[model samples]
Target: MRALVLRHDHASQPGLVGDRLIERGYDLTTLTVVPEERFHSPDVTFAFPSAAEWDLVVSLGAPWSVYDEETIGTWIAGELALLREARDLGVPVLGICFGAQALATAFGGSVEPAPFPELGWTDVQSDIPDLVSSGPWFQWHYDRCVLPPGAVEIARNVAGLQAFVAGRSLGVQFHPEITAPVLRAWLDLDGGTLCARLGIDPDELVSRTLAERPQALARTAELVDAFLDRIALPVG
Candidate 1:
């Protein structure tokens, strides 16, 4: 099967999730929205392919906020329309972090700044641990998704709703795609300063992520298995 990954920035490579998809026999091609020159820029103009061509779609996270329509309104508007069209066409979608926020916004829901952002490892609460487990999953987002219409919430934490399933789509607030080098790549790009401002030490976060690798892999394997067997496959 072919999986079209909507990559929004340089640091937001599919990482572990892409690895999982590869293991599951998926041919993955990422469509980068923000080009090299616009990689770090908030306002960008790009194109999204017709959703009918792919078996599955994944929208990865972005540094830019989904609600920043004043600046990226045009870009975000196009994305929302694309997502809505994908959903209408019954294409299964997996949305991560900012991607999830975009999914929420596309489906008659909303995204807003959280009371506080989740910067590092934080536990999640989910009744369906087989599909969604309590993490200490990697998190780095300032916004939260309000559940979309017909969306059944699958997970949560003190911060807010962590995951939900809508039609053929699964949206999660945490980053299951994180890895040591991925974390390092993000750190290389002002992650240290960003964490420091939040009173989190980047080195410590990196250390924890490194330590969490083995278990994280296994966890993501389970996540992908269930996501494929349950969320994507059933519909696909």
Candidate 2:
């Protein structure tokens, strides 16, 4: 199988998700939306697939808000269009954090800045906790998604809905795909600002995350494996 990985920022790496996909024999085609060369101006001008070409699409987290289309321009529209196309084609999609907000917006739902931003290790409530575990799932987001129409709430926590599944698509609030390298990059860069906003110390969060990463990543890999297996199965 093949998968398309849509990444918005350099810090938000696919981590265990990519490793699991490779293990499952999925050839990944990664699209780094906000590359170093185009960091200042991320241009999103590409024809979205009609799903006859791809098996699955995985949209990763972004530092920017999904609703800030004015700054991002028509690229946001293009992404939303892609989400709609994927849904119509019945292609499985896995959206993480900002990507989840984008998916919600694309599917008639809305995204707004939360009353309180979620940052750092947080707990989550899930019917399938084993499929999606509770804390210490890495989180760094100011906005949250309202469930899109026809979506089933899969997980939640004090912060809000942690996960939801719609048809063959899944949207998750936490960063189950985070790795040590990715975390380090995020913490060294934009995390300080996010930390100050949350009244947290960046170094402290990084240390805590490093301690928790081993087990957290293990569980995350397991979850990715399960998700892919579920979607890869043939319909009878």
Candidate 3:
């Protein structure tokens, strides 16, 4: 099977998710919306492939807000169309964080600002621990998604909806695709700004991420494996 992995920025690569996909013998083709030259700039252009080409689509996390298509340009709409096409084709999709918000927007769902932004490791409540467990998952987004129509709510917390499944697709609010290297990159790049806004010490956040990453990333790999297996099954 082939997986189309979406990378919104250089820092937030698929991380552990990529490794698990490789182990499962799935070829990964990555699409970078914001290239290295415009990594900090929000002028992202997406050349989304047709849904029939890939067995599964995995949209990674991004720092940008999903609703700000004014600055991000028409690429947001293109991504949404691609997501919709994937759903229409019965191609399973796994959306993470900002990607989840994008998936929500693609399917008549809405993205709203959260009362409290989750910026570091935190535990969420999950309905299916066997598939999507409550976690000490890494989080960095300020917005949350309302489950789309026909979606099954799978996870939540004090913040709001954390995960849901719609047919073959799954949208998760946390970063189950995170790795220590990716975590460090995210911290080195965007952690300071979030720290100031959230009134958190950047150093403390980094320390906690580094210390807790081994276990957190392991669980993340497990979650990814479960999701892939579940969606990749042969249906009647």
Candidate 4:
């Protein structure tokens, strides 16, 4: 099967998720929306390929908020249209963090600043424990997605909704594809400053993640497996 990965940030790369997808015999192609030079200020010139080109679409996280139309208006609009088109054409989607917010928005939901932001690892409650587990999931987001009408929530925590299913799409608020190197790049890009403000030591956060790499990697594999076998298959 052909899979499309839409990477929204320079810092966020598909780590274990890509590995697992390849292992499952998927031909994956990454379509990067923003140029490395214009990471913060994304240009909307990039357009998505037609639904016939890809059987699945995975939208990665970003540093920007989905509701920041005042700034990333053109890009957000284009993405919204693209996501809507993907849904209409019956393509299965997996959206993470900001990508989840975009999915929510496209499916009759809204994204807004959360009352409490999740920065580090956090525990969550999932309907399917085997497919989705609670505890120590990597999180880094300030916005939250309101579940679309008729959507089934997959996981959640005290902060807000964590994961949900809308039609053939899965939206996750946490970052399951994070690796030590990717986390480090994010920390270097003002994430460490946010950690500092939250009384969290950036070094410790990175160290903890690096230490738990084995478990996190396995968890990501399971997540992808569940996505393909459970969500993606049902829709595809």
Candidate 5:
């Protein structure tokens, strides 16, 4: 099968999720929206491909908000349109963080600043443990999703909605694909300053991620398996 993995910026990669998808017999096509050189000025023209061409679509996280058109105006609308078309066509989507917010917006929901940014490993209350696991998943976001119409919220925590399902798509506010290197890359890109401002130790965060690597890999694999078996494949 073919999978289209949307990497929102230079830093965010497919990571463990992509690895599992490959193991499940998927050929991935990764598209990077914002190049590293253009990180300062992220308003770059990008044409999102049609969702019909891929067997599965995975939208990764981003540092920007879906509602912030001023920074991402060049491609956010196109991406939202693509996601909406995917939903209409019954294409399975796995949306993470910013991607989840975009998915929520595309499906008639809205994104807004959270009461406070969630910036570390956190636990969630899962309504459907078989599909959405309740655990300390890696999180790094400043916005929350107001679930779209017909969407079933599967999990949540003190922050807000954590995971929701609509049709053949699943959107999660945490980053299942996060790896130590990915975290470091994010930190290299002004994330360290953000961490400092938030009183989080960057080195400690990276070290903890390294320590959680094995368990995280297992959890990510289980989530992807559940999503494919219970959500994506049934309709796909």
Candidate 6:
């Protein structure tokens, strides 16, 4: 099978999610939207590929908001169009954080600033424990998703909607692909100051992520399997 992984920024690697997909026999083709040099000014014109070419699509998190067109104006519309086409073509999508916000917007929902940011490992209330678990998932986002029409909410917490399912697509507000190196890469950017502003110690966050690596790997694997077996594949 083939999987198209969308890496929104230079720092956002596919991490464990990509690893699991590889282990599941997928040939991944990752497309990086914003290169490291262009991280400061991210408005770039990118032509998204058609959704019909891939068996699965995974959209990773980004530091930008989906509603902030002024900063991502050149490519956000194209991405949304790609997502819509993916949905229409029955291509399964796994959207994380900013990608989730984009998925929601593409399906007639909206993205807005959360009452407060969720910036660390936190547990959510999951309706389907077998598929979407109630977990201490890593989070690093300033916005929340208002679920699209016909979307069944799968998980949530005080921060707002955490995970939702619409057709063959699953969008989650947290980052299941986060790793210590990924966290460090994000910190190398302006994330360190953002953490300081939120009273989050970057070092501690990295340490916690390192410590929880094993469990995170297990959870991510299970999530990918569930998405494939229950959502993506046709029933026998």
Q: Rate the local accuracy (lDDT) of all candidates.
A: 0.87, 0.79, 0.83, 0.86, 0.92, 0.92
Q: How far does residue 59 in candidate 6 sit from its true spot (Å)?
A: 0.5
How well is each residue in 1-236 modelled by candidate 2, as lDDT tens digits?
A: 87988888766777888877888788998877676656546555555555557888889998888888655656778778888898887778889999888888888888888778888888788887767776568888888899999888889877787888777788898888876678778877777767787799877777877888778868887778767666434456
The digit string of per-residue lDDT tens for model 6 on 11-64 reads: 999899999999999999999998888898999988899999999999999999
TM-score per prediction, in order, is 0.96, 0.91, 0.93, 0.95, 0.98, 0.98
Candidate 1, poorest ten consecutive residues by summed lDDT: 35-44
Error of 2 at 207 (Å): 1.7
**lDDT tens digits by residue: candidate 4, 1-50:** 99989898677788878888999998999988877787766655766677
Order of candidate numbers by lDDT, starting with the best: 6, 5, 1, 4, 3, 2
Q: Give RMSD to native, each candidate.
A: 1.4, 1.9, 1.6, 1.5, 1.0, 1.0
Candidates 4 and 6 compared by TM-score, better number: 6
In angstroms, the error of model 3 at 95 is 0.4
| Candidate 5 lowest-lDDT run of ten | 227-236
Better of 4 and 6 by lDDT: 6
| Number of backbone-clashing residue pairs for each candidate, in the order shown | 0, 0, 0, 0, 0, 0
Per-residue lDDT tens digits of candidate 3, residues 61-176?
88888998777777888889999998888888899999899988898898999888888888888889877777788788889998888788899998988988877888999987
Error of 1 at 29 (Å): 0.5
Clashing pairs in 1: none
- In terms of lDDT, model 2 sits at 0.79
